[model samples]
Target: MADKAVDALSENEARDELARLSDLLARANRAYHAEDAPDISDADYDRLKRRNAEIEARFAHLKRQDSPSEQVGAAPAEGFSKVRHAVRMMSLSNAFDDEDIDDFDASIRRYLGLSDSDPLRYTGEPKIDGLSLSLRYEHGRLIQAATRGDGSEGENVTANARTIADIPDTLSGAPEVLEVRGEVYMSHADFADLNARQSARGGKTFANPRNAAAGSLRQLDANITRDRPLRFFAYSWGELTAPLAETQVQAIARLKDLGFQTNPLTSLCDGPEQMLAHYRQIEKQRATLGYDIDGVVYKVNDLGFQARLGFRSTTPRWAIAHKFPAELAWTRLESIDIQVGRTGALSPVARLTPVTVGGVVVSNATLHNEDYIAGRDSEGNEIREGKDIRVGDWVQVYRAGDVIPKVADVDLGKRPKDAKPFEFPTTCPECGSDAIREEGDAVRRCSGGMICPAQAIEKLKHLVSRAAFDIEGLGAKQVEQFYTDGWVKEPADIFDLKEKFGSGIQQLKNREGWGEKSANNLFDAIDERRSIALGRVIFALGIRHVGESASNLLARHYGTWSVFESAMLEAAPMEGPAWDDLLSIDGVGKVMAQSLVSAMNQEAERASIDRLVAHLNIQEAERPATDGSPVAGKTVVFTGTLEKMSRAEAKARAESLGAKVSGSVSKKTDIVVAGPGAGSKEKKAQELGLTVLDEDGWLELIGG
Candidate 1:
C-alpha cells in the first residue's frame, strides 16, 4: 500500500492489514528459516513488518498475542524430530553503517557504566552466509546437532551435520558435555560446481551460496548432504560443562586447535573505529573471498564482559551485525506469466531478460499478484503512484537479504513507445476455467476445481505426500508420469496399479526408470498402507480448507468414516439441523463445514471416494480413554491462563478426557476454567451461574 493510504487507514482497515501482515510474515519466516526456501524478498518482508508495527503502535487494543513483533521465526519444518535448546540461539540486532556501529558502542558503554577510555576489546569477523548449526558433545563425543528453529527448539539435523568434514566425530581433552555452535556453509566455488551439476541433471539449482548451504544441510537423505561440499566454522559455544578460554578470541583459537575450522579474518579490535576498518576491509574483499559474506559481526572479546551485558528479548546487547548494501542491476522485462498453485490461486511471475544479480543469473522474479502487476493494492489504491510495469520496460532487480532476485525499481522514461500494460489472465491458463476473485481476497482463483489440470496435478502430488499416503519410491516425478501414462489418475488408482500390472504385457517393472527390486519395493510400500487411519484418508483427499489438524478434529468427532460420511451427506443440503451439528463441533468453523459438505456433494469427488474406500479398511480414529470421568462429553471453555500447564497442554488434556474445548463461553458451556486476568468469558459464565474453576480445581477434577 502507498505510504499516504497506509497512514490514512480506518480502524477496520488497520485490523485487516494487521491480520494480513501477521499471516504473510509468519509464512515468510517459515519459508526462510524453517524450510530454507524464501518466497519473498527481504525488502518486502521489512516493508510489511514496519507497517504492522506502525498499526500496532496506533491501535494498541487490537494488538494480537501472536504478533510478528513477538516472534523470532517459525517452528521447525516437519520430518525431523524436535530438540529443545538448553541455551537460546538468539538473533543479532543489525547495524547498517559506521554511524550505527558508533551508536551500538555508545549504548553498550552507557549500559555498562564504562568511560571512553575503558579499553574494551571487541572481535570483528565476517558473518558467513550459511545455516546455523548447534553440535552437542557428550563425554567428548559428538552426539547431536540441531537447527536454530525459533531459538528455543530446533530440528534435529545430526546426521546431516555429521556429514560435513569440519565437524569432528569425537573430541579429545574436552568438557564432559559441550554444545558447539557454528555456521554450516558452502564456498562460492562449491556453490558454482553444485549448481553446474544441478543444471546438468535438470534439478532445482539454488539462487545463492547461502540457500545452497541451507538446502544441503537440511536434507532428509544424509547421502545427498555428504556429496555436497559443505564446511563449518565454530564461533561460539553453548551449554559447556567447562570453559575453553577466558575470552571469545581465545575460545575460537582453542576450537581451531581442536581440529575445527574458524574464520581466519577474525581480529581483536580495540574500539569501534578498528571494527569499522575491519568491516570495510571485509566488504572490499567480499568479491574474492571464495564464499558468501553478507556482513561483519562485532562481539565483545572478553567472555566476562559479554556475560555481564545480558540480552534483550530477541538479541544480545554486546553484539551487532553490520550489513553490507544490497546488490542491484537493471534488466528488461521480457514478459509475464501466471502460475496456478494447488489451491487454485493464480500467481503472476515476471520473465526478465537474463542478467546477473549477486553472481546468480536472474531470469524471473515474482510479480506477487494482479494487484502488484497493476501497481495497485487489493483496495485499488495506487502504490508508487500508479506507475504500472509493462513488457520491454527497464526494471532494476536486487538481492535484498542474501536471497531472492526481485524488481526494486523501474525507469519510466526508458519505456518503449508501443509498450502496453500487461493483462493478467481472467481464465485458467491450463484449462481455460473462469478465474474468480472473492470479496476481500488478494488473488484470483480458478473455478474449474479438479478439471483444471494444474490444480489436479498438484492435488495428485499431495495425495502421496509424507503426511498423507506417503507411498515410498513414488515421488512427484513418478506421480506425474503415472498420471500422464494413465496408470494412476486419482488417489484410488494408486491402489489398483499392482492389480493392473501384475502379469500384464506392459508392466511397471519394464518401464524406463523401473527395475525388479525398486518396483517390488514400491508395491510392498503400497500394500503396507492398505489399512490406513481415518484422519490420513481425509487429509489425503486434499479437500479445500481441510488440513491435517482439521481432519483429525473431524476424525475424533465422528470416530469412523461411516458416521462422518453420513453426517457430511446429510449436511450437503447446506442448512439444517445437520449443518448446525457439524458447526457445533469444536475447532470446526463454518468455512470448513461448508467445504466438507460441498466436497461430499460433488458427484466426481464422491465417486472417487467410493472407489478408494472399496479397496482398503480405513481404521476408526482412536480417542483417549475417558471411562468414569464426570467431564466426559462436556463442552468446556478455558479463559485467561493456567499455571501448572501451558494452554496447549491444557486443551489436549481436556480433549483427552472427552471434554470439548470451545473458544468462548456460551449457554451450552458445562465448565469454565478461569485463571488470573480472566476476561469477558469469566463474566459471562458467572452471569449464567456456570461452574468456574481455578487452575488447582481443574487439576483436582481431572485427577492429575
Candidate 2:
C-alpha cells in the first residue's frame, strides 16, 4: 500500500506544520504581547516560543483553537481597568550562560531529590531594569497598576501607577486582592540629575536606568509620572486575596509591612554555596551600588519549594539570572580623541583622567578599534607598548560586563620613557578626509559621510538624541554650542532651533544658570519633540547599520519612514529573499550590511538624507497588535526559551512591523519561528524544506 501513502504524506506534513506554528506563535504573541517593542533575541525569541509550547504540549490533537496555549496576558489594553489576574503573572527563567546557571542548579537538585547535604535556602535580589508593574491591592487602597501584559494581560498604569513612591498609595493590613510584583527604577542619582538637566536644558538624555523607568512609566502625563524621579523594587507575588507569608522572607516582610521599597539588597541564602556567596557579595558592592545592576536574582527560599518546583513555560524552574563579569576599571589614558561617526566611523576616543567605574563618572571611553588601541591591558602590559599611550599615559580602563570600556593592561613597569610612540591619525580629525583602513576591518573610517565637520557634529548630536529628537534645547552641550556658534549645521539644523534660538533666547535669559523660568522650560522641551517616534525617527538618523537595537529593528521593519526608505534605497544587488530578508534582522550581521551599503553609497551620504528629510516628521510606527490584530508585517524568526516575551520586547515587536525580522536561517526564510531549544535555525529550517512555525503555532498564526 506504499506504507499508507507514506503515512498519508507524514500526516499532511504535520497538518501544514501545525498551521504554520499557529501563525508564527500568534504573530510572536502580537509582536510580544501587544507590542511595546521587540523583534527577536531573548535567544531567538525563546527558541520560537519554546517550540510553540512543545508543539502545544505534544499534539493535544494538534492544539491551536486560538492558542498561545490558552493565553494569560493581552486583552484589557483600551484605557486600562481590566483586573483578572488573581495570581498568574509568572515570567522568570533566563540565565544567559554559566551553563544556564549550572543547569539551573542541576534542575533544583533534580526536582528536590536533593544530593550533597540539603539546606538549599537561596534568596539574592537586585534585577530592577524597570517596568514590570502588577500592583493591584483592594483594601490596601491603591486600586490598580497593571503592565506585565500577556502573563495575564496588563497596561492600566492606574493614574501613572499613582505616581510611584515605592508604590504604596495607602496600605497597612488592608488586603482583599493584593498582587504586588515590582521594578520601576530610575535612580543612579535620578540618572545623574536626569542627565544633568538634559544637559543644561538643550534637552534629550537618558540612555539608561531602564530607559528612565520605561520613559517615566508611559506618561500621557500622570504629571509626567509625577515629575520623573520614579523608583520601586519590591520583588514578586502577583495575586493574593489573602495568605501573606511562609517565606520569600515573609513575602518581603509583607512588602515592607505594606508600604514597599523592599530591595535593601535582599539576601538570606544557605546553599548553592550561599547562592554563590551572595553573587560575589553583589559583585563586590557593584561600584558602591544605588542602581543599575543587570543581574544576581537567585530565589527558591521555599514557598513549599516554589509550589513543588512548578513553572517552565518561560523561567521560574525555581529562579536564576546570575550575571556580573563585565565592569573592569583602571584610568589615566588622558587623551586620544578622533570620533566622526554618522557612518564615517573613525572612532578612537580615550581621554580618561576621571574614574568611578560601574556607577558612571567614566571621563571618556571607547578605544574600540586600532586593534583596540594596539591591544593588551588587564595587566599583561603593552597599551601602545607600556604607557606609550602618549598624551599622558597611565592607561588601564576596561568595563567588560555591559561591554564597551577598552585599554586593558598598560603599566609597562609604570613607564613614561618620555611617553611617545603616539602618531595614530591618518587624517580626518574632523574633516581633512583620507582616514582609510578597510581591507577586513579594525575601523579607521571617515571617508567623509556628509562632508565631515566631525561627521556633521556627530550627526547633529545623534539627531537630538536621548533616544532621538528628545530635543529640549539640544544638549551634547547644546550640540557643542550649536557647533561652536555657527549655530547648528545639520539633521536639518534641529528644525532650525526656533528660528536659530530666537536671538539665543535673550542670551539664554541673561546666562548664569539661566532665568525666565529656565528659558521657558527650554522652549517647552523643544516644543515637545515636534512630533516623532518611528523608533525616534530611526534613532535620529545616524544610520550605518543603526543602533538602539537597530533603531527598534528599523522601526518594527518599515511601519513607515517611507517603507524604511524604500528598503534602504534598494537599486538591485540585495539577492535571494531580498538577501534573506535583509540578513534576517535579529541583531543583523555581514558587518551590519556592509555598514549599511557603505553609508548609502556616500555622495555625502546622499546629501545627509536629503537634508535630514527636510526638517523631519517621518512618523508611522504605532502597530501595538496583541489580540486585536497587527503583529505589523510579520516575518519573526526566534529560537529558544521565550516563555512570554522580552528579548527587548522581541526586537521591539519585529521593528513595529512592515516585517523583516532576521538572525540567520537563509534561502530567504519567510517564517522559521522554531523554539524549545531550536538549534542551527531549526537545523537550517529543516534542511531547507523551509517553513517551520511552533511557539503555539507562532501564536495561532498571528492572532495570539
Candidate 3:
C-alpha cells in the first residue's frame, strides 16, 4: 500500500484500491463463511472493513454494487441447520470521518423533506466488537436464539446463548412475541483468564476478545460454551409482536427493564456534532471499557422516522457505525527496495513477508526516506525509538486510516542475528547519475535532469502533455516503448523519428503496431511542430520548479530562447545581474531561476539542446497584449460554438499573440470571446461589463 492516507489517494490509487479490496474481501468471505475457517483474525477483519468504508467515503462514485459495505457476515457457516430470521438482521453502514456523519444527517433530512432548522434526534450506542445474535422470545418466554449469519439465516446458537448470564431466559412486561437483536461478546478480563485456562490445558488460544466470543458461541457442545466467558448486550428488537416504545431511547430502556443487558453508554444525541463528540469520548474510554467496541452505532430515535427510512438491501439508511482507527501489528521486514519517481527522486519501500494488518494483506510499507530508515526524521529528531530499520528485523506496522502502510516501531528483540543496517544508494540506480542532496532538502535527487533514463521517460511524457510540446502520435505509451527500444531517449529524439526510420532499411512501419501510413502521419505531425513557442520549449524541459506560468514569465522576459539561454548560462556560476534579471520577472522565484540556470549550465545538457535547436526554428515570445493592440497580456475566455475556427485553433492563435486563454471568466478577465451559444461565462462577462466580443468581433480585433 502507498504511504498516503485514505484522503490522499489519487484517482488511479483509488481505482486500484477498490479492485484490491474487492478481491481480498471476497476471499475472506469465502474463507470465513463458506469454509468456516477464518484466514484473518477478527481485529484484522474489522480493520479491513473500516478501511474499505473510509475509502468508499472518500470515493463514493467508485463504490461497487458487490461491495463489502452491502454485505453482513458470510452466509451462515455451512454446518448446522440455518434458522431463518423473522426480521432481517442487517449490518450497519460505517462513518469514518466527521464529514461522513454530517452527510448522513443531511441525507436523512433531505430524504424526510425536513429543513436544517428541524431537529432529528438519534440514539448513539456502542458497536461491540463481537458476533451479532437474534434471540426470539415468544409469549414473554425465551423461545430461541440464533446468530446473525447472513442477515437472513443464521446458525442456531440458542443452547450456547442460554449459558450467558446476561441473556434472560424469560421476559416480563415485554412484547408478547419479540425478537431481541444484539451482540455476543467476551469482556477483556474474562477473555484473558479464558486464554490462560486454554493455554494451561494445551488448547487453541484466541487472538482477541471478539474471536474468543465467536469461537465460544459457535461451539457444537453447550458444555464447552458454558466454560468460556461469553456475554450479551440487547440493543434493538428485530421482530416485535407489539410496540415496545414510540422512540428508540425508550425502547432500549424498556429492554433493560425487561431484564436484558443493554449498553449503559446508549444515549440520545442531538446532532452530528454531538454524535461525533460522543464518538471521540467513547474512543478515549475504549482501552478500559472491559469489553471491546469497534465503533459507535447511531440510530434515528423516532420509531416512525426509522420505519420510513427502512433498509437498503443490507443496512438501514437511518443508522450508521462510526468505526475507530485500524490496529497495529508486528511483522518481519524481508527487504527494502527503492522506487524512482518521474522527478528522479528515489523513494525507499519496505518489502514485507505478506503479513496481514488490520485485515488487508500488506506486502509493502513506505520507509519514507533514508532518515526514516535510520530512525531519524529530516530534522534529525529521534523516530521509531532511535532504531534504524534493517532487513530481517521485526517491525510494527500501523495502517491507522492511511491507505499507505507506515512503519510505526521496530522490535529490536526479534532482530535477526544476520540483520545488517541498510546502506542507502548514493548513485542513480537506473542511469548511474550523481545523486546529491541540497541543503535543507529532505530528499536526494539525481542531477541528471532529462539525461537520466528515468527522468528522460518522465520528461518525455510531460513534453507531449497539453501545456507543453503536445506532439501528436507520441503519447506516454509510445514514448516509453521508443525509449526502451533505444529509438528515443530525450525530447529531441521525438523530432528525429522520421529521418531515422524514413529509410527502407529500418522502417518504423515494420513495428508490431505501426504501418506505413501511420508512420508517415506521425512524421507529418512532427514536422507541424518544428516552429514552437519559447514558453512551451521551457515548460517541456521539466525543470524542477519551472511550470507553465514560470516558463511563460521567462519566455516573455527574455523574448527569445538564445537570450534566455545566454542569461541562464551567464547567471549559473554566481548571483549576478544576469540572475537578478531572471528573478525580476513576475511569478519567477529564486529557486526556479536557480533550477533553470543549473539545467542550462550542464555541458551534456547544452549539447543535447543545441542538437534540438538545429532541428527547429524557436519563436520569440510575443509582447503582452496589454502593451500591444487588442487582447495583449490580458486574460481572455472563450466559450460556445465557433464557426470561423475550432476552439484549439482560437486558443493557439490567442496564446501566440501573448493573450492568456483562461477557461473561466473572472474579475481579472479583460475580454470574453463568445460564440453562437455562449452560456454562463458570456453572461458573467456582460454583468462584469468587461469587453465582450463575438467570434467575428474577436477575429477582426486580432486581425485573424
lDDT by residue (347-374, candidate 1, tens digit) is: 7777899877767666877776788778
Greater-lDDT candidate between 2 and 3: 3
Error of 2 at 217 (Å): 6.8
Question: TM-score per candidate, in order?
Answer: 0.70, 0.27, 0.49
Model 3: per-residue Cα lDDT over 1-704, one tens digit each? 32236876765566555544554565466555444445444434555676787887887655543467766666555235578899888877777789989999998997777899999999899889777889999988887899887677788888998899999998888778999989888888998899899999999977667667888988888999999888899898888879999999999889999998899999789999899889988999987888878789999999999987766657888999887877787888888987665667777888888766653456777675787788885556676668999999998887632133667788898888888899998998988988886554556678776678888887787787545775666777788989989988876788887777656224687887788777877788788889899988887776655555567767876789889888988898758778665554433545456667887887887788777778888899977544565666777888899887666568867877777776667677888889989999899999999999999999999986
Local distance difference test values of all predictions, in order: 0.81, 0.62, 0.76
Q: Which predicted model would earn the best TM-score?
A: 1
Candidate 1 overall lDDT versus native: 0.81
By TM-score, how accurate is candidate 1?
A: 0.70
> Highest lDDT, which number?
1
Q: Model 2: per-residue lDDT, tens digit, 470-571?
A: 555456666767677675676666566657768547766775656777777776776667677777776577664355445665576667877666666672
lDDT order, best first, reads: 1, 3, 2
